[model samples]
Target: MNIAYPYAVSLEEDGVYFVQFRDLEEAFTQGASLEEAAFNAAEVLTGILAYRLDHNQEIPAPSAAQPGERLATPGVEVQSALLLRQARAGRSLSDLANAMQTSWPAVQRLENPHHWPTLKQLDKAARALGKRLVLSLE
Candidate 1:
């Protein structure tokens, strides 16, 4: 379940680099170099998702990477958001709260990208959702 987003990158006439996610209309960022642009892409994607979460907006599913596009993999905060969203599909907050032996507010906070949840807490949430939390390094 890699939630990496595919984005188009271009060089502007002013020698600035631009990155945009076709799936997310609100996401766009610029940088002076490709490395910075790529970094900003991840940051922008995370920010977009966080904003949506904060405002209770719908989060669109990430599309597959096509040819000639860069992949912007979100950090742990965004990844947690994805996991929590998937875990909540077809379920109720009370159900999850009961499964995790926590309060509804706590469960909601767990899904909040602005909140920093520990891996242990995430693992517990995964188990409550009948999923396992796994980690890998590249």
Candidate 2:
């Protein structure tokens, strides 16, 4: 199963930026900038998920975008997964938008944890990030 969670990447009064997941409210990772925050967030998510799997805890029930608001799409978790993968590869939002020849805001909307992407767009994003997406019915 897949799960999508909130990620608030905000710039504080200082020059530093941080990313904290809604699912892991108690935990937060910070960086000097958005790129670094995105990178560290990926690491944090990997560790968090690994801990859950090791402890046999149920994955957080896809709580980011609500159940039906996204329509028939690849689901929030998968889109988040793609977002993380691209972030891991050091691909910034502008980089991806440039590659896809779209506006930066379009890609930003696709990556924002609370928003949803259409199924076709999800596929395009995954492919852009060097990932393969599959949908399974539970």
Candidate 3:
């Protein structure tokens, strides 16, 4: 799934610009100008996704952009959580649990948005999936 979600920008009567994500009703922000609004929109989106991830809530897939829509991406943490789940491919959660020397429920929690994973945990998970964990600072 694409990290960046589409948003609708609108100018209010007070001359402030507002941004709301089409796929995320909980994500919204405003700024004095279009540029600032867009910037704030990104921050808002990241926060929303982070909260959902932290709460083990479902993260919606980015919707296709309509006319005049802008896109915003989630933060690295959220991306990592998602990638960990996606890396499983078609393998059952139980398979990963066995690989990690744990129970299936434990493996499931690793993919849970609300379950905060440490770096070492993520590294182990990547290895279990036959992948390497790579990190870079943007």
The best candidate in terms of TM-score: 1
TM-score each candidate. Answer: 0.94, 0.43, 0.68
lDDT of 1 by residue, 1-138 (tens): 677889999999999999999899889999999999999999999988888877878878889888989988777787797678876796987899999999999888888888888989889999999899888775
How accurate locally, in lDDT, is each candidate? 0.87, 0.60, 0.80
Best candidate according to lDDT: 1
Question: Which scores greater on lDDT, model 2 or model 3?
Answer: 3
lDDT tens digits by residue: candidate 3, 29-97: 999988898889888887788787667577777888998998877666667767876688778888898
Clashes of each: 0, 0, 3
lDDT over C-alpha atoms for residue 120 of model 3? 85
Residue 90's lDDT in candidate 1: 66
Pairs that clash in candidate 3: 53-113, 54-114, 56-114
Model 2, stretches more than 4 Å misplaced?
1-4, 65-138
Q: Which ten residues in a row have the lowest lDDT in candidate 2?
A: 66-75
